[model samples]
Target: MVKRQAQHIQVDLQRQQLRLLSGDACIASYAISSARNGAGESRGSECTPRGLHSIRLKIGDGLPENSVFIGRRPTGEIYTPALAAADPGRDWILTRILWLSGLEPGRNRGGSVDSLRRFIYIHGTPDSEPMGQAASHGCIRMRNRELIELFERVRVGTVVEIRERC
Candidate 1:
């Protein structure tokens, strides 16, 4: 029997935390900022979808820390406090991206609820942004360094379980 990949990554929404696990043991923990609109399963809801998902794509290989991305492509810009002050309304996707694909059928997979279609990702944010709170439009937001570390550790198909509570 194959031990499922689901146990490797866990997101506790209630705590605004993400864990990197080895079997039942946690290898690392990172504070996260989830959807400010809370949890839901709909495209354009601006809320995090709760379910089993896989890291469908891991982007930003060989990029510098705080490298900026838009539309999943590097924009030839590195994030800086000055740049942020210039474009205060910009929803920054920095460092790396772990684009997610939902595993559940109707809940988060197909139709309007599809996470991939929704462009849901676990990506990095500017360090100035607050962590350990619900703040993002939809994506799971992490600090750049932590996200870089996680991006290095996990594979493309690693399963992630996002939960509403512990």
Candidate 2:
């Protein structure tokens, strides 16, 4: 039996897209949101830390769409317009989540901009969240349906590269 290496994940801030690359070929691409203020290489800055990372945890597997999650745990309630309206201040995390950990030591790991310590993730969001736009508070956000598919395709230890557009 052949052992297959995990796919690589790439997030291009300029393109506002996340790509799943298998070897040298692109397998999937989806809209993504980075930091609102732009990228950085520090922890606790609420800025999207740059450099290489890995999937530290994959949360909310097998969950239905609109499934509510807080701190990465299912809340057991489906999202609705009414719920959103009632808690407009909520930073909604829905569908699926892929928690990321920084690989660089001084640049984006174990410091203020540490992606793992920063709780950065590529997660599902409400459709209302704008795509191809920089609107998140440092994490990457995708549509619920799209993220569900991505969550299923990727695995822990998948490499993630966040880079500026050239």
Best-matching candidate per TM-score: 1
Predicted structure with the largest lDDT when compared to the true one: 1
Could you tell me the TM-score of candidate 2? 0.92
Model 1 C-alpha RMSD to native:
1.7
Candidate 2 local Cα displacement, residue 127, angstroms: 0.7
- Once model 1 is optimally superposed onto the true structure by TM-score, how far is the C-alpha of residue 27 displaced, in angstroms? 0.5
**Poorest 10 consecutive residues by lDDT, candidate 1:** 1-10
lDDT of 2 by residue, 1-166 (tens): 2233557888899889999899868899898888887888665566787888989999988889989998889999999989999999676889988999988887768857678888899988888888998988889999998898888888898888899872
Q: Give Cα distance to truth, residue 135, candidate 1, Å.
A: 0.3
Candidate 1 stretches greater than 4 Å from native: 1-3
